[model samples]
Target chain A: MSKYLLDKFLYTVDRDPELVERYREDPAGLVTWWESEMANSILNCHGDERSTWLAFTDEERTALREHDHVTLFEMGAHPFLTLTLFIAMFERDHGPLEYQIAYGKAMEHLTLPYPDIAT
Target chain B: MATVCAVIASTHHPFYYRASTSTGADRPPFADEWVAKIETFRETLTKARPDVLVMVGSDHFHQLWLDNMPQFLVGKAPYFDANWYNEEREFGLPRMTLAGDEELATHILRNGLDADFDLAFSNELRIDHSITCPIITLRPEADLPIVPIYTNIFAPPLPRPQRFVDLGKAIRAMVESWPSDKRVAIIGTGHLSLELGGPRQFGEHGPDPEFDRKAVEWIANGDLEGCCGDVTLDSLHLPGNATHGFMDFMLMMGVAGEGQKADHVDSLDLFHTMEAYFTWYPEGVPTP
Candidate 1:
């Protein structure tokens, strides 16, 4: 179990909640939302990375198996992501396995360590 | 004697005394050891002393965003008493007349499209710190007459990777094609590090030194083939917040030329960062 302090990885999630939310479950919405969201983020960056991130549109997120979906365990997610995950988990009629698998796929990108700087 | 001109570009790393000496505090990698490097660039520029300079660099949210964004912006007007939002470096040049190389700009647009790029043409954007930063640093003691070019690389649909290389070839062809045999030395600015405003920005990355070393090595080896190598879309999506700015270097490279060996003159390493590039030109070329 990896622990994440809030201050470190917060911006990666907080800065783009609306788009990250859709990518978590809404497949159709993910396409349109990410296009504009990525544009906004890339323009703010420094250099070649601008054109670099644009490639995300073509990258298919690798899917996780049904048994592995676990949004609650994602320690670094923004408060909004947790909220979305909660609603999808309890209030929905979908099978528990679907949420489990979906959460797993999304969490991989989410769980990447913040590359913490420790002196 | 050929009339030589300079193109100044850089990371716009600001240095201030009273502020936090932590490099990433005010601006990542600025106040740290790179402070001396930026000052050294100014010194070398003073020594090399070109007659006229056409600065090539990018702008932040300084001029365009949200309400307005120009596809491709160019500023050929004299900028005296320009604005500086952050404590970044101030413009060091006095106001002078500026001319739009409508000929060059038109050629870029035409060639950019022929080379499969979409660029909006404009003559009315404000001169940004990206251009003014290196200008003031290189010639802090005096202001030189200037021409400026801007790219939407920070924005989107950035010209294809190869297009940047062609842009360099196009500009060189255009410059030499012109009757004026100006003493021209092109500069490609920006960095080899990936620390941005993210949390890790306060500290250095383990990978940054490796990245910096590889980049400078390519530059010194005159690896124009590698320098302007394909900046694939996947690599651009790295963690740093400022990775987008490197595209501006490609725009400058359009004029810098291939097989041009860069003799590294200075390198400042701190917090896993290196602010460096090849020499302005080889000894064979008549230097200023």
Candidate 2:
């Protein structure tokens, strides 16, 4: 599981607002840096199937859009950070509720049932 | 000279309500019923007229981070502000302030250290939904000042359920020793079972209603030993990721005092999360 990546990503973002702002300013550069600085080390040391994530083609990296949130979640990303990243990336475009809905959808993808209670 | 002591507990999450609309198919069944139950408990709290509240809940990466999480952190600030993020505002939660009892909080910290519990103290702490939502529900008016105690239920190396109960006992002793005539109540807020961001995040088998019911029964009977002895970490985590929040209930049991049965118990099974409330009266008080 890439819980290490997810946890580190969440921890850094939650604690450092500047990192989040940098990410907002340059999503592609941040992703590239994350791949080189964070993900590469984790994958190299842990040696998981995610090793393939290192050699992503430029087109593949470009395709890594905001909608890939569920993919990240399924890959063992922390839910709080996954949602936080999603919000940071797309909250302006789709609004806040969209992120919440996306989280519910991602949780559904994980097979966790939503609580049957009114808002 | 502390007077009345009561335990108010609930399970809350920001996303639980955010994803669903107010009406139509999005609304879960018996939602109004759950609200009614909370309202009833709110009325019960108002009748008690507690001067101060000792709120026990866990922090969700708000005040503490993975690097410096404390097993037990007490707020010593005179005023605790709500950590309402923009995301939380989207769910209709407002940012607000609640009065904090600095003296009682300091006493609890000192007494806990004296009792050999290495407790962490925070002079400035922002509260998340874990306790804030319950405060809004149980004390919407925020009339009573609060002393918030944060337990480390999110991070690893979580204290044993028994430790929580023991901490509760320490808290009880501290509150009772206060040289004041103020009425004090303890509010423990958390879910029975919740698998947030875990592998079983969307799994139906994660929430066990039977387990929740049995837990309610144990609390109602004031069977702290039974709960501590029977409910293992594996059993709780097996049902959900954040089941560690159940430690809050154990803490509540400790505060309720020994042999003091819950005069009132109410529970609502919210599918993936079990919301429960229990009220324990002080010794020799007849249920009114």
Candidate 3:
């Protein structure tokens, strides 16, 4: 459960317009390509400085590939990153705040003591 | 020495920029009242007649990342390019450029490190909405040079609520001791019982109204002991997942000093979160 890696994917994609569109249009393709290419790259460093060992577990990969926010939340992926990225991709399809409200309702069954987001 | 003219604290709601500016049917029902409240709040800073602003806010994983995050950072540069692409996309926040008070930033960094804060300094920084929201509402001209101080409220292993208070006190002292004729208004923004991207988010009111009520009182009355006694890194989670942002308010409380009542206070109950505004005049309230 590499929450850090999960957040990196969300953070990296959320900031780039092209990545947001690509992830929205093709989640599985983006996830596969991101994992194979961008996941281990040090954000503030050059490409050659990228670390070699950072890889997401199968569950994390599946959650990202499916854009499953509920599962992402339960897995301790940062909720803010997940929500922001999801809203960017999907909010246009729904009415004002419809996507955000629905996103929360989906997690209504979950109680407090929500998954720890510490990295 | 620089005079501490006004110490202000507020909730940095990103929606305010869009809400207050939208016209006709595009504006939300609550926009009018929110604008009125902000106008009144803006007056507190305006009457103080500040020459420079010391803005305190946290980075929302914008420039600072987990790979290397600074608990407290000071932006020391000639200018700061404000708002991010994501902020513009999400909040309709216009891109801004504000002049940086490098002299004040240098003083804070030098004295802050000597004071054992181990502060990090950024030569070039793009500020997010936490700082800009207040600028839009209070100083829309974006005219004054500013020294931006960022705290780490979003990430875990955060500095304790008491630590925020201590830093606030330290900041106030640093400004007061600076050898300058400038009048500095220290402004910081944080949340009050907010829940973002969680089950209780986007509710009719903030997720925890009770917490917001107590938080307002603690800040307005400058009750640092009561606030820190009840608030901790662990206890903050109960009010709302994102309530740690409240520590920035505590930091402002420290600048206001313990038991010093705020000169101006107001609040607005909005859908997602409550907006609270406070201003303290260390040198008595200025007459308009």
Candidate 4:
């Protein structure tokens, strides 16, 4: 009935810088931990109606690790946080210009007006 | 009787540093001049010596989350703290505390509910820049006790602007009914026009001077309908991420009394954000 895991994952990473760092340090390990937590919570009868983590396929995990934003967006990740994650990733690797480019692409995907990047 | 009712509109986060600090490095060109004006305004507030100040501001997703965001929140805590984190700490604002007026706040909650306004009460609300920045700049000593009423602007299904005005009226009524001889001042903190965390987050796409000018004029003139009526969600959203802050201004104008004239108006255009300060004198209140 709900994609709680995906929502919680995106929301947590968006609001918590430390979690973002953990995810950046080890995406696979982070996802594994999340899956284990979900399993433990479900066993304890404290789970939501449905967990997206339980339904996530191997290909989806690969896409998440590969930074395929479109795939994640289609899978129901929050658009704003998706864009924020993209900018954060791009900024770390290729400076501010690449971050702007990533922002432009994210805006295009979200159908927001493209911004005139201030020089 | 209330001694003063003012609207101090400002950009909350990054722009807060512009007023709190003396340095202008990496800030907009108008930073120094704006800081000077705010300092003068602070002097006026000090001279007023209000016993209790009711501050209206909106939370920026720091305290509330998507799980349960309240439209209107009143702080009932005895002390309000600015629990800053990350970028908020960059402003170098020391851990600040403002005495809270629990009695007045409780009365507001009761009055708001009685007036058909469902209000959320918070005993542990941690304020963000929206309220703290203005306090640090205008009332650093925190001498006057404060009552904070938070309106929800970040999330959808935001209370209509008229609702905010009605809430202000409710608060005014509560203050009028109180038996105490305390002089109260109501200060609304927020921006006129600006965007944040959107596509133009880093661009010079806003502070729409035309819109800001009209808004300030409407507020100063105490024209509630002109300021908040027919304000569409699309219009607010299109302007910028945090343009919803205008709701706080509407609440302040409502409290200042309808059709009352502004005794003083200080407006500054900081390119990306327009800041307006207005003090309205209700009938028989001699201007200080």
Candidate 5:
């Protein structure tokens, strides 16, 4: 399912302020641009050292483009990454933890044992 | 030989710094009680007169990424620049730089490796709230030089719960044998029953209060036998998806040793999660 790539997308986007805003403002545009331009570029290495095989599945891309945390969790993308990035992007709109509470309630149907997050 | 003054474990709630420091209507109702409990907890370490600290905490995907994650890592730098931008954005944690004790970091790395643990070493490390949260709650002055140890509690394919306990025991031994006269306080922080990005998260209480109750009793009384018998990598998910972080507390239980009752134990049942603090005096309680 390329959960690692899904997490890598969240990890890279969450750390940069500009990217967080861009992703929030235009999820579809950011997702397309990230998959094409930034997906294979190794974090610490030069552009030439990029890994060629890393790409998101259609569902994974759709989940990111839609900002679908529920699908991300079901896909076993790292929960902490999803929660942190989502909070940064969305928490400001709501009053004091309202976003966090609603975020959890969204997946009320999911039960333990949650999806395995192992890479 | 160095004296292991205090073996302390706690919940590193990132929201604490903001909560405790806020004023007027901005301050949450629970801040006062949290601060009071923390002040009492802080005195447990202060009374011991520790000169150096061995800080045990896990990195929450800050500097160490999935590309090449280490199971256990020791930061051996001259200094550590604490807190991150995301932490600032989310938790409102201020930027801090704490002095690093390279000698103790070196001793732990060398001895920890010799003692059969393959630990990774970082010459430059920027720490996250896992380490700083305790620093804020317990030692606000942030004066003591520290040796930072990062564990992999967040990532999967994690080491067994037993490994965390074993490492704690090894750390206690290593510190006692460091050949320095400095009094060292070994401090570690982790969660009780946390659920992040799960259906059960951000609830009125922790995702599982029953688990939190049992977990606190296990730590307070130093019941590693009972704790280890019940806790497993797979079983931790029953309490909460993020409950694996409880292993860091188990690691401290190892440091406190079996049947070594904590001298100070306190808990605050805050919204979303419970905050528990524990302190054990390996060489008997220090005089105030």
Candidate 6:
């Protein structure tokens, strides 16, 4: 059941808006379709010495950013998805549920919290 | 009776990819994770013994990376491997010999494009885990043939989600039209998460039960629109590692259809939900 459950978890978060917001003023027009996994993965996608994403990294963060566009793509944060961060900070919190359940094991594997595991 | 099985996609973390490893790092740590993967993939291959395995997934800069990457790319190859290199880790590489069903694959591509879905092609690109993981799960040893599909989740000029859905419909038509008598196995792989990177780590390893519950709800009941949001929905995460290959899954579903009642497999065994779809025909239904 756990394995089956895991698959279900993959599917649920894979396609749904793991993060979003709905305010009375905006109503239907304001529903933010945010994919938490990409945001999470992007957080960990630091750049190496040779990177296509280096130019995008700010000077202060350069030594730390390992920032590469190609890696950024791998983070699942496509250029098209750049606006999600804004959606997240502005919208309601998706929950601690996906994070809560998978966090422990994820930590065990040394797998960062980039892709909100439980979603 | 003839059949062609296929796999689908969504966003996935290729451990060898830059985001998964260190910066300025050219080579990835391969052997450790891959050998382990090959070891396990063998068992599943033994269980669902099929004539051919069709692996459908999205493409990154790997193939087109060298040659102007396209929004959508597909390949019919005799062998597939991942030259995945991690700057930090030793990219333990594993090469697998895959079989190609050119007739079926070509038909599906042509039809999908005929329906106006800009499908691209390459004879020389290697595939990532998007296809390999499921393959490893079933055929850990790599003694079989595979059909590789490319998607546009990562690059631009990608087809719209609904357009991909239509591509799925075309795929269904192409599959049903195949003339060979083949028992095929298709596995759709991807993540079920929208956010990647930063503090949002879903934490690697094991099933996240809450996320698992929501995933089940979407699949079991057929809430495509509700689960996926408006088909017209667009955002940065649209082609996320989790959602990247989703349309591929939908395409397979369209091809597999609900008429055949697929038995959902247990998920805990692996990181993905391996649901078995059915296409069993009524004993007397005369092969269509």
After superposing candidate 3, which stretches have Cα over 4 Å from the reference? none
Compute the interface RMSD for candidate 3.
0.6
Give the per-residue Cα lDDT of candidate 3 at B166: 97
> Can you give the DockQ of every candidate in the order shown?
0.03, 0.13, 0.87, 0.17, 0.93, 0.03
lDDT, candidate 5, B13-64, per-residue tens: 9999999999999999999999999999999999999999999999999999
Tens-place lDDT digits, model 2, residues B45-156: 7767689999898887666765466889999998999855644533556687988999899888888999999999988888877777777778878777889999987666
Query: Best-fitting candidate, measured by lDDT?
Result: 5
lDDT for B226 in candidate 2 is: 84
Q: Pick by DockQ: which candidate is best?
A: 5
Interface RMSD, candidates in the order listed: 16.0, 9.0, 0.6, 8.7, 0.5, 14.7
Residue B217 error for model 1, in Å?
Answer: 1.8
RMSD (Cα, Å) for all candidates, in order, is: 13.0, 7.4, 0.6, 5.5, 0.6, 14.7
Error of 2 at A92 (Å): 9.5
Write the residue-wise lDDT of candidate 5 on A1-119 in tens digits: 88899999999999999999999999999999999999999998989888999889899999999999999999999999999999999999999999999999999999877888999
The worst-scoring run of ten residues by lDDT in candidate 5 chain A lies at A110-119
Candidate 1 per-residue lDDT over residues A1-119, each given as its tens digit? 12122211122322344533544466445444444454335445664454433322221221111112233233222222233233333325465235433443454454334332211
TM-scores, all candidates, are 0.57, 0.77, 0.99, 0.78, 0.99, 0.55
List ranges where model 6 is wrong by over 4 Å.
Answer: A1-119, B5-49, B87-93, B156-158, B202-212, B222-232, B235-245, B258-261, B269-288
Backbone collision tally, model 2: 6
Task: Kindly list the per-residue Cα lDDT of model 1 for residues B104-222, writing each as its tens digit.
Answer: 45544565556555555555555555555565556554345554556655545456555655665665564454445445445545655553323323243323565556656654554
Candidate 3 residue-wise lDDT, B111-142, digit = tens: 99999999999999999999999999999999
On a 0 to 1 DockQ scale, where is model 6?
0.03
- TM-score between candidate 1 and the true structure: 0.57
